[model samples]
Target: MTITTTLEPVTGPFVWRGDELSRTDDWIFRLGPDQVAELEEVGRRFIADDPDLRTVSAAQYPLTAAAEAIRRFGADMDSGRGFVLIRGLRMEEYDDTLAAAIFYLIGLHLGEPIRQNELGDLIDHIVGVSDKAYEEGGLPSRTRDKLPYHSDSSDAVALMCLRPPASGGLSSLVSGATVFNELLARRPDLAPLLLEPWHYDWRRQDPDAPADTYTSPIVSWTQGCFSMYAGADMIESAHRYPGVPPLTGPQREALALIEEITYSDGVALDMDFQPGDIQWLLNYAALHSRTEFVNGADFAHTRHLLRLWLRRDVGRPLVENFGKHVVVDRSSTRTEDAVRDTQGHFRIREAAAVRTDWGD
Candidate 1:
């Protein structure tokens, strides 16, 4: 397997500066009244049917009026800006069931929803369940820590805001291409190190995983296409396990430099999430993170979001084993048989409900 360490800097629409996007609303797609009404109608009927979440198809809830807009959204994430903020769902009018149903319906149109954990939840509830620190193995989504910029193991990831935090928790994104180009310009000597495989902690995933660690390069360039898979936490934590190679001095420097660049001025775009907003990002093109947040005292005021890891069928070319962390066969763990409550709603995992070392 040959790797292109001296690849030229990537250039495309996916390369963007956060400060530049801040001045425009092009990334935002506001749903129209008709689209919202259509979603509500379909969402209610789907909830009434209460079909298995995994078995439900997009055709069942045909978002006829919003189909074109939805297609454009896919285009934006794929070829335009690598992310989209969908605004305009009226949260007050719907309960948790309706909201989840609606988000699931839209997700179906986007791609196949994959299992997010060992329990096989197609839609994972992201809420802070504890105040534990990440160093203590606390789940990032279950704690109020400042998440670092990183990409998930999926073609695309979606988050629909069900409830916003009382303060902070601002979601931020940085273009991986932009970051790569900057690294090339500033320190070409270190750029090749990114194409070298680095150990990632697979123990943070399912206990039944084949290996305790997996290796993959940070950047992969294939057939003139660029893709990136990054998680500083995962790479750094892998060293704790036996048999994993230690990080060299240059590797440490490269990692530190990447993080420093991600947090540098104008690199990351931050958004204060609002209830009823859905943000979709192409994992290969951009890295996302969150600010430390404060949740309210009551459950009603708790910060909550619905997450989806989508296996998009779009033919985006990628190098072999680029995202080895993503689970491929979920047939045994699929959420088709998830239990439901008397209210005909799937039980959502509470905050801090995840394993401290769980990786997603």
Candidate 2:
């Protein structure tokens, strides 16, 4: 793998500061009334047909009313800002099943949804089922702990807010390019270390995996394009397993500086999620985080978000081993015959109680 150094700062539409972005509403795309009606009609039809999700395609459910808008959203994520917030779904009109169908329909237009877990689930639920931390054996998706800024294992990631928590649970995102440019300017010595191979815990993603850990560089530059894959918690946790080397002093300092840059003022953009709002992000261009939240006792009122990891039809170049952990299969071979329950809804509560797949 040839890792070239670029001391010159990366300048593009993707390199945006949060404080500057917050002052403008340009990143948000609101659905019009005609579009919402078209979505509702198609969503209900999808639930009625009940086709196998594994084989469904964008061609099967055409969204003529919103096709142009969806295409723009895709362009914005890929070439503009690396992220977009789509609002105005009118959540009160539909139940969980219909809501999921709408989210899935839009996702199909954007990209192919990949399996999110060993269960081969295309959609993963983000809800706090337990109060314990992930380090204590609890799943991060099922806990209320604050998640650190990290990239998921896919070309892009989309989240649809079905229910907002009663208290705090703001979703935040930081530009990986912006962070890298700042680091290069402030700590040039540490920037090169991110290109070196680093060990990360694999048991966190799958308990029964053949290997306990996997290796990858935090940053990669190829063909004049830059990509990033980061999760400091996973890098630090790799120390628990045997055969993995300990992090050197400079390596530790590099990790610290990266985190400091992400948390610095104007670096991370915070989004107060609203019901029916969906946020799409390019995984290589952005790292996302969430604040700890409080949920009500009622399961019906609990905070719930649907997550989809997509393999884009259009993608950027990457160096070798930069993102080897996530296997983006065209179709899942390990999923259950039926991912949803008899009531035509995903059994999120039951799945959360027993699921072991955990990552940011």
lDDT of 1 by residue, 55-111 (tens): 567877777898988999899998888999999999998877788878888888998
Please give me the total number of clashing residue pairs in predicted model 2.
0
Q: What's the true lDDT of residue 39 in model 2?
A: 94
lDDT of 1 at 178: 86
lDDT of all the models against the reference? 0.79, 0.80
Per-model TM-score, in order, reads: 0.90, 0.90
- Residue-level error in angstroms, candidate 1, position 5: 10
- Residues 1-360, model 2: lDDT tens digits: 122346567778888899999999999999999999999999888877776676788899999999999999999888888999999899988777788888888988998877665546677788887756776866667878788888887888998998888888899999999999898899888888988889887777655344778888998877777888898988998888988989999999888988999999989999999889999999888999999898887875678998888888555777888864555453644335434222122332232232343443
Per-residue error for 143 in candidate 2, Å, reads 0.7
Residue runs of model 2 more than 4 Å from their true location after superposition: 1-5, 208-210, 334-360
